[model samples]
Target: MKRILAVLLVMALLMSCVSLAVAEEKKSLTVWIPQYQFSKAEDAISDQDFWDGVFDKFEEENNCEVKVEIVGWGVYGDTFFTSLLNEDGPDVVYVTDNYDLVKRDLLLGLDPYLTDEQKDNYILWSTAPENAAGEKVIVPMDDGVAIGYVNTDILAEAGYDELPLEWDAFIEAGKIIQEKTGKRAFLQNWGATSGTSALMLAFWPYYFQAGGKMLDENGQISINNEAGLKTVEFLKKLFDEGIFDEDIVTESESVDKFANGEVAYIVADLNKGNTTFTPAGVNWQYVFSLKGDAGFGARTATDSFAVNKKTLERGNDELAVKALVYITSGEVMDAFHSQIFYLPPYTKDASFVKDEALYALTSAHSDAIYVVEEFEAKKSFEDTLLANIQDMFQGNLTPQEVLDETMEYYNTQLKEE
Candidate 1:
């Protein structure tokens, strides 16, 4: 009986040793990236292949492997939100707004990992104050601007060689384009399918042009004021005069229309000029921003890379941050932006552009660009304002009514959240 008990104890000890070995094995860190742009052609190296080579270098340096998942926009949001409820979230992920996650304490503070010199080297833009803890939460990935695109062919047919730079002149040109070509003069996307940030990009520049500020001295929402009302009224005028496509509320095909020569102008991310227009063989040019009451107000965007707090649980927080730093380094961004023809993340990268004239034109307007503050309530405010704007476009609500309703909803949502 003693021998039997000894044999049982030995078996248990062996099992315990096996379990310990398995627990100590290095686990792969996962990364999630959304489809932000067309980085390669069908015949070119695949994104997966490019990343595999990049990760192999990282693994060699850090002594750990990485798994990357590239997701489309349609599933990116839902996948992220669902992952937040469990332990399946990525170690590093791409985010346009990290304030929401910061509020939940789900992001790792990046201040310790990044040096002061490094921070000053890149254009961090307006993301510094997004964290209540006052710690850096993101690394700016790329520079983007919401600009106007006009089909030069259509403009030539309409008797205009270049697009006007002021609001009134812009309207006059739009009317002429519609009258002469029988095509929609401009397109706006306010449909439910549009991303909230995209909706904000479509609408906020107009408010800025109307001399509006998003907040007052006390830092409360002041969007219901004169500037807000004027922006709404101007959009209403566009629909009333048949210049802005009335079908925008139901269709998110503004880019497609511009590519097919069905529309004369569109307001979209500056990258679209390369991603869609140039490839489609459409002759096009950019209008940075129309001169507005506030001197020149164009909305610019700077999405970022953030490390998830869950990475700490795996005892690989430092490794994850190192991977993030490597990806955002000037050398990597230079290569990445070159592939997509996007505005480079570093000022020095401007010299790398194939078309110096085009790059200079885009970069010259940097002073006029402003990024919307990434406040904690930004997502909610954008969603609420988008619905109200659609109602105004549908003629169910007046411009004033839209502003009033949106401000009220914003206040109530803030209180509840």
Candidate 2:
């Protein structure tokens, strides 16, 4: 009996040592991402479940733990910056723009991890990956284009069979829409609540249509010119004629209103229409950005994944990059965008497209789509521009004054930067 007890005790000690060795062998990585179009309903798969589904296989294969945190958009920027300043958290992060982070040298370049096949197969922005000097900091995941959603029923009622494609005719159509249908002609959200999306969807397209470039030959912001004035004056015309309501400056429900058949037209990102308008049974067709004196133009936005430089300090830089590559692989991005929005996958291998016809239509307008240029003072420039536009809408500033003031502020901010 004493011999048997000694043998059992020796076996138990060996097992305990084995467990400790395995624990030491495992590695961990943390990923921070903003909640992008995720459903929060009780019946919906939880964000954790979705991430686990994507990462579990990787974890099992590599003996690594991947921790994903889905953050709210409101607090994401502040939280990310704060955590980064502390030299902790987030091995990888979702990036819409990495200008500021790259400027601060807080992001890692992705060129080493990218394969030749990926470089050849992925549809990338002209300046992406190398948007900051020659550093390849971002790996493209998904992309969306801004489009005008024209309520077909409203168009017909307003004595038009289809929305016009030219700026002058489009404004004339808006006037006719109000005169005949007794409803608002167009709705655009200009409030701060709508944030940069409003600028991307409604304002930038028109400005671009008028040939307004954000910067001049010397790389300074210069919007107080013919293109800027034309765009603002056109908007003021829509306001003065009552085609669009003054309340647009504060209205956050333009899309909802248009979805419910209360407005003739609304400009929104192409990915948004199927969610609100389709469910409401609003008969609508997309209208590409209208032509102006310069030409037709609209902004397409891209979302990507980037590595945080903090991973180097944690001694898991390669592991973190491997996780990022896995997360943004063509197959993963294809499945992810399919579940959330109708955005096109940047990778060629991702085959799921929700609507082929709509995809074809949007693709036809690809020539006119330009990505927003990243600069040091992008946030402040956009904010001041939006504020000045609001003031112009409220009759506090003329269209010329709007351009003059916004241009001055943008230049001053750039100089200080």
Candidate 3:
């Protein structure tokens, strides 16, 4: 009887050990990314194929399983913030221009995991505001600048050889195109609420060209000054010339107008390099923003990788950080750009990009890829300014009134915050 009891006790112990081993072997992780390139199955899984392959490689190397979830870029902020509030959430997340505002409570600080040298490998601007506190919150994956897309065919038809080099020249060309073609010269995405970031992208070059600065080094609002006013007046002139599409408030309508060849020029980012002109089968060329009075200036935005703090605190941070480093590596970035057709974040030689039109724009406008660090703490103010500008576009307010109302609203928000 004693022997039988001993055998049974040993068997029970053995089974318990086996169960624990199985649980340990079943390691898994989740990653949340934007839907931009990953929305379609071909682009997400096959065309680039590297993202999935890299995840699988990480799984093999770490002996774990990775699950990727695609979220829309528009809703990523809300979804990521809400998920962070929950105990069970993704181990890693992706962020873009909105990271600075979203990092307050939602993101994990990676200072504890990364060495100084490891951190130094990344572009400082790509990680900033989030990493301003010496805590690394994001890793940059890709970088690109806003650029001008001109349908040269339309310009040639209007009796122009190339895009105008200055704002006045640009306007004159547009007017000529309108007169010759009886179609809108420029089609911009605009609406009644606030100028879309796209419009802001278009307007920024002009502001810089007009010798205006968005803010000073001390973070004071400088855009309300005379130079900034001139910039607003320039946009108003464009609107009044009847060169821009009538439905400036609706982007879809603007896009339709441009796509149908009813518009001569459009403003776009690098991602649109392939889709906007190529898909339309139009003979188009990209130009750097026409030189502004203060020299040419451009605004660049980035999307980065960030880890979840709660997950790191739970002792799973090393894997997350490793995954981030892998994704942000030059090889991965180059591969991603090759597939998605975006500018690389890392400052590397892009001689390999064989597309002449893209290469020309990137080369000439390279200086305009303004890193975020170049600007101070006025993103909120800029947002308000953009909103008020949209109100001006809608004709609900004059340019001067828009500036005054925006300043008032911004000051009030500053006090409340």
List CA RMSD, all candidates. Answer: 5.1, 2.2, 4.0
Clashing pairs in 3: 190-248, 190-249, 191-249, 209-292, 209-293
Question: Model 2, range 1-417, lDDT digits (tens) per residue?
Answer: 999999999999999999999998898988887776555446665556677789998899889898998888785666786666676668888776566777787788766766777666667734574635576777766577787888999889977888886887888888888889888888888864534656887688898999888767976667788998999998888788777677879877788889889998887877767777887899998777788888888877766777888787788888888888788777777767766455766667778787676688767877777776676677767777788888888889999998888777666655465
Question: Which residue pairs clash in candidate 1?
Answer: none
TM for every model, in the order presented, reads 0.86, 0.93, 0.83
Question: Which candidate gets the maximum TM-score versus the true structure?
Answer: 2
Best-fitting candidate, measured by lDDT?
Answer: 2
Give the least accurate 10-residue stretch of model 3, judged by summed lDDT.
39-48
Q: How close is candidate 3 to the true structure, as a TM-score?
A: 0.83
Give the whole-model CA lDDT for all candidates, comma-separated: 0.74, 0.77, 0.67
lDDT of 2 at 129: 45
Give the clash total for candidate 2. 0
lDDT of 2 at 57: 89
TM-score of model 1 (CA atoms): 0.86
Q: lDDT by residue for model 3 over 1-417, one digit each (tens)?
A: 999999999999999999889778766677887755633435344432556776877888887777888776665656776776788878887765444434355576777777776777775433455544666577665566667777777888888898886777778888988899787788766552333354456566667667776556764555677767777887888888766544665554555556677778876675564666567777777776666566676666656777877776666777877877777766666666666455644634223353666666666666565654423234556667666766787787787877788777767764243
Alpha carbon lDDT at 238, candidate 3: 85
